[model samples]
Target chain A: MNNPADLRYATSHEWVRLEGEIATVGISDHAQEELTDVVFVELPAVGRAVDAGDPTAVVESVKAASDIYAPISGEVVEVNPEVEADPSLVNTDPYGKGWIFKLKVKDAAHVSKLMDAAAYAAQIS
Target chain B: MISEIKSSPLEAAHVVLGAKLVPFAGWNMPVQYTSIIDEHTAVRTACGIFDISHMGQFIASGPTAAAWLNGLLTNDIAKLGIGEGQYTLMLNEAGGVIDDLIAYRTGETEFFLVVNASMIDEDFAWMDARKNANVTLRNESAQWAGMAIQGPTAVEVFAKVFPDETLPPRNGIMTTAAGAVVCRTGYTGEDGFEFFSPAAEGIAWWDKFLAAGAKPCGLGARDSLRLEMGYPLNGNDLSPERTPVEAGLGFFCALEKGDFIGRETLARQKTDGPAVKLTALRYLDKGPPPRAHYPVVSADGTVLGELASGVLSPSLMTGIGMAYLPAEFSKIGTPLQIEVRGRLFSAEVVKKPFYKPAPSA
Candidate 1:
């Protein structure tokens, strides 16, 4: 599994890359592999406020649907339209073009408190 | 209250193929080898092999076997000639389905039955309690390992694997020189055969089919393929509380044949019409794949029923499912909604099968 050193991750397998107060969120490679062949993605609505651990989106495969949880409390800033048109992007490029949504962080420090690449790798390993 | 999970004879082969194993019908079975869609497409366009050892097999013999089975099963066993098979159902006295299976006349007085894995003990006990003196029933499920090789290319793969043997006609059963039984039948609407042999030889036969160009498929692909053809699954689409009539399987039930268990209720339902019908539905727009137990709603937002089975059809690239809706709502072109989580997606009642395969060459 590729755990980029610059990105922090939640135990739920979502990776967040913080830029200023904006945190870009997407499921990690390990999560995408577990839920293979993503056929549909339900993105969270913009401006929706979510607390940490809240299920903000859904990623579905042929077999079952999974909840993509909010790693940290934030307001939904933007959602990825690319995944909506072609859901396979989540499986093909989970970390880059497959990002699910962007959130305006409530507290930017919370992003640092989450697991770093090393700790996240250890947990998944 | 925990029970032991059963293992297929070919479990080791599945592990070697890197299959994702899951618990299904109290057995550790592979859900997929590579991916459900990939395997499903293989079975649709090429050839795919599935380990069906988890299903149950039984042998019934004696001079009166045919007459006796005809009384117990919904199909008229008298119609089957030697080496012929037909899909039939065993039902409770109240007309509810006990199990749906294929009964093959392997000989003049002997019949072979392949039943759902979870219904083995119950089906056996139900039959044994009512068995007549002239018939002898035996459960040989544990002695056999089964595999279904299915697809348009299945015949080609079979020819490559068994160059000396000729495949039986559709719904026909033939024994190979090595004592293996090959039946020209499968759940997927494709030209294929289900092979059964001694339990110890499962992996060898599996390897032979694979070497002959059959792709290894798991329960996931098997499910989608069957559902695409609108085949009813025993535990999912069929149950003890529902009769075959409500399941849209009246054609398989021979009402004109003499008396049988559950015939009275089926006959009554056929005349009076079932209040609920197992209706097929397709999503009108892109949505998350529907699944069993999802609440189905009417146009005016009335809760009609829940889905019996549902999936994002790998072939159609749209959500398709079956639900036991009220008879009035079961008609074709009726509008419906499938509620996933809290969102309601529009769907419409359509024909039984969501897909149709190309005719075999």
Candidate 2:
């Protein structure tokens, strides 16, 4: 509930924050709550091209496995090596330490249509 | 994941505490509230309570009820004293298991059976079709709620909550002041009780236990605990097409007893020898965790069997699973291979009760 205002969300529960030409991506609080207890996350290879709405990374919990879809089509500039070393960071602070990758957005205009804190909360409700 | 909402008696309470509700089988139940390891350890070292309300409860009673149950169950129910419970199996005519259950003999003419939630309707029909007027069978699952308080400190917690009367003393049934059917029986291979009460009263009793200081455990820990004990879940290890003969649960079947519903088939299988037996496997190399239906291969990577149940055991620190492998591979220390996520991982067939702690050792 840290006012997800600055972060933009996808219908699949991922969040993207634009920083200059780079966008930091990770799952939102609602997604982390639903996934629960992140055990192991398969990191995206740095410098890989990703398409939106497709599996870019995999996460395995004690219960089941899931895929994290790329919120926007992009080229992966860097992966969070810390998250691969400690996956629980996603469950602790999904917005910060849990960021999956930094993507160079292919279409910056699409970010405007994504939900903010208020709209994302409304969408989940 | 399909996240359609369904409510159990404690649905509101679980939502309030931010439980990760998942669709298990058919009901929406909490998979875990916090971490699976924390809850799993809580149930092993201390105490954890579970809302087993989704399981089915049944009653079959009358002058003929005992006789009917004798024919239906593999165990010798007639041998049980009043207030005693015995593990039993209901089988199809082909000796395939219909469901595995625990029957509590409330009296000579009264009995209570706890069965898998998913098979209640079919099992009830099977029992009813074979039932005679000397006995009566009724599905009481909807009217009752089953809750389990498990682990080493279970008795202490129960004693504090119900100080007025004796709770079941270690696998014994004892009436409690809480007006619940308290049985010291558990599936976790630990000291605990599975308590049953009217459905409406379950909510209050669940709250009462929590207020009295019991941790609410979820399905995640329950699966891990039972798996470690080599207890085959009904749907997984004991399927309708599989019999005690194939599942390595023949110990619960009494072949010498009087004729039962599936006695003939089971007897034939016993005489011929079980072609396959349930085997335990542990991964030798760290890899993707094995899951149900994953194939079990041989030393040279020949397919032997498929996994029946698999889980990441925090206690074992590896992927432990069960499979119905050929008799040759059922021995302890049988090195085998498990295909996890399409990759073969070196695994060994181990013995049951894999990690029995020193107290239960």
Top candidate on TM-score is 1
Candidate 1: which docking quality band?
A: high
lDDT of 1 at B54: 91
- The residue ranges of model 1 lying beyond 4 angstroms of the native Cα positions read none
Residue ranges of candidate 2 with Cα displaced over 4 Å = A3-7, A17-24, A45-48, A75-78, A102-122, B1-28, B303-305, B357-361
Please give, as one word, the docking class of candidate 2.
acceptable
Give the per-residue lDDT of model 1 (tens digit) for A12-124: 99999999999999999999998888999999999999999999999999998999999999999999999999999999998899999999999999998899999999998
Displacement of the residue A110 alpha carbon in candidate 2, Å: 5.7
lDDT for each candidate structure: 0.95, 0.83
Can you write out model 2's per-residue Cα lDDT over B1-361, one digit (the tens) per residue? 7644445766777788777788766678888888787888888888898888888888888988887898899998887778888889999888888989899888879998888877887889988888876787889887877789988887778878788767655556655665679887888888889988888887788887787667888999899889988899987888877889888778889888899988887888889988888898988866555778999999987999799998877677578899998888888898999986566888888878867854742
lDDT of 1 by residue, B311-355 (tens): 999999999999999999999999999999989999999997789
